[model samples]
Target: MTYLASPSTLFGRLINRTQYADLPWSNILAINFLRGRLNRLSANLPNLIEELSDENLQSAWKVLQPLYYDLYMLRAIQESKQIVQPGETLTREEALRLLHFP
Candidate 1:
């Protein structure tokens, strides 16, 4: 038989693990960063789609390939609890590297 933890149980475990009061603030900042990227993409993608030129395609690829890796990172975050070393903190550049940002 297979066993699966419910979402609330998983969330509870996460809540229990975190001891920082600033975690929510960090989460909000991350969400805003992603939201800004998404907004820019929404604003720009239509122009690329309508134009369909070589330069525009290249531009779109440059903008999107990192986003593709970021999506993978999001999945990894959901499924893996081993992304970071124990008690080791990541710098902003290191985080960008994990996203495969160019």
Candidate 2:
């Protein structure tokens, strides 16, 4: 007998659709860092959509991990009283707090 995987699990569909090459190198590194951390935490962890729905996992990611600037950019843009450049750099501690993981 032969079996076929579900459409969701199809080999071609597993290719990452995001154009990582179009992102800045810093953003790419940040994404890779988060992916590595999550994989190290659980080899069989579900895809991002499912994982994000788990409150405990979300809390763990928020409170127990280092922050990445890419993840903090949105809020900084929304709340900042001054215009900040996308390429601006913050001190490590400041960046961590801005990302809300410090």
Candidate 3:
């Protein structure tokens, strides 16, 4: 019987051999592309919030909370030199303000 190696072990071995410079440009390009899409989504969020029903508003907030957090982290990572400022992180209240829900 053949035993398969754990995926994490394989992934770790692969990562050990890889350098940041060896990464593909397509991966960087995709991240930049996603950043732009997130920007557009954030710009339109206020208007989108206005169109939701009471029940759906809660659902929208639930969905947006994580998305906004991820966007904030991505922006912070892109802008900061591996040290993100405390102010760069988004609070729940700040997120609601940005969405124009309050």
Candidate 4:
């Protein structure tokens, strides 16, 4: 428990537990909802970025920063197996790790 007391602890927790993390079907549905939005955001990012002139890069940075981080973290999670046939519920650390962080 002490290990997860801080934000940095949660960051470290994600790397180890992201693999094969299980999720309930309802949660899966919700994740799918958000994932569609995320996909749209990700797809637009490059074009939006390309339209920016050098002077506007500062403003673009704000959007790109969060987008980049989410992509990395999401990729980490997806490296795990998705939708196991037996449908295991997520374990303690993984459950905490997924919902608690951004």
Candidate 5:
């Protein structure tokens, strides 16, 4: 049987193998790729949802949400770090809304 680690574990392993200085750009590239994939999926979602039973859709969402949330947080943090000016900082409400901080 194959055992899979959590998404964060897998992501950490990938990053640790790369040069730290390359992380910001590499992460941005990954984010863009994921965004494109998500956009394509979203465009198809209505048809897909029409065919899916509610139980099946819920099951798929349960599996997908964590991976998507992790990638989102990674993108947010990376972009926040890359912000160069005080004016570029996210507003308190915007940061809260985007990051879903507790």
Candidate 6:
């Protein structure tokens, strides 16, 4: 039997083994790839929904996949350190108060 770790764990292992210097991905290419993939996936969703039966196991599997991918992308962004998560948000007044605190 094969045991699979959570997506975050998988990503951690992958990044640790991967050499960023050898990566072919750039911001522009990544943006374009995501845009193209989103458009294609959006167009296909209706067809996919139509082809799958609600009572079938595949229907529930399809439902979980999108949620998993969303969580995966969010985790990637948070791990990158370039983006902030919602819990990190500070009110404008709170921010100014912190800046001026003696």
Best candidate, lDDT: 5
Give the per-residue lDDT digits (tens) of candidate 4, residues 1-102: 011123332233222224435756666566556656655666566687678788788766676678667866765666554645444667889889998894
lDDT (tens digit, per residue) of candidate 2 on 3-26: 122223322222232755576777
Give per-residue lDDT, candidate 6, residue 99.
94
Candidate with the greatest TM-score versus the true structure = 3
How many pairs of residues collide in each model?
Answer: 0, 0, 0, 0, 0, 0
- The better-scoring model by lDDT among 1 and 3 is 3
Q: Any residue pairs clashing in model 2, and if so which?
A: none
Cα RMSD (Å) between model 1 and the true structure? 14.2
TM-score of 5: 0.40
Model 6, 13-62: lDDT tens per residue? 23321456465567546745656666567656667767766686466767
Q: Which ranges in model 2 have alpha carbons more than 4 Å from their true place?
A: 1-18, 44-102
How would you encode candidate 3's per-residue C-alpha lDDT over 1-102 as one tens digit per residue? 111323233233222213556768777566556666665676676687778898988876787778667866765666685687778778998898989965
lDDT per model, in order? 0.59, 0.52, 0.60, 0.57, 0.65, 0.59
> Per-candidate TM vs. native?
0.29, 0.25, 0.41, 0.33, 0.40, 0.32
lDDT of 5: 0.65
After TM-score superposition, the amount by which residue 88's alpha carbon in candidate 5 deviates from its true location, in angstroms, is 12
lDDT of 1 by residue, 58-95 (tens): 88779877866786676678666666666577788898
Ranking by lDDT: 5, 3, 1, 6, 4, 2
Shift in Å, residue 50, candidate 2: 21
TM-score of 3: 0.41
| Clashing pairs in model 4, backbone N/Cα/C closer than 3 A | none
Worst 10 residues of 2 by lDDT: 1-10
What is the total number of backbone clashes in candidate 5? 0
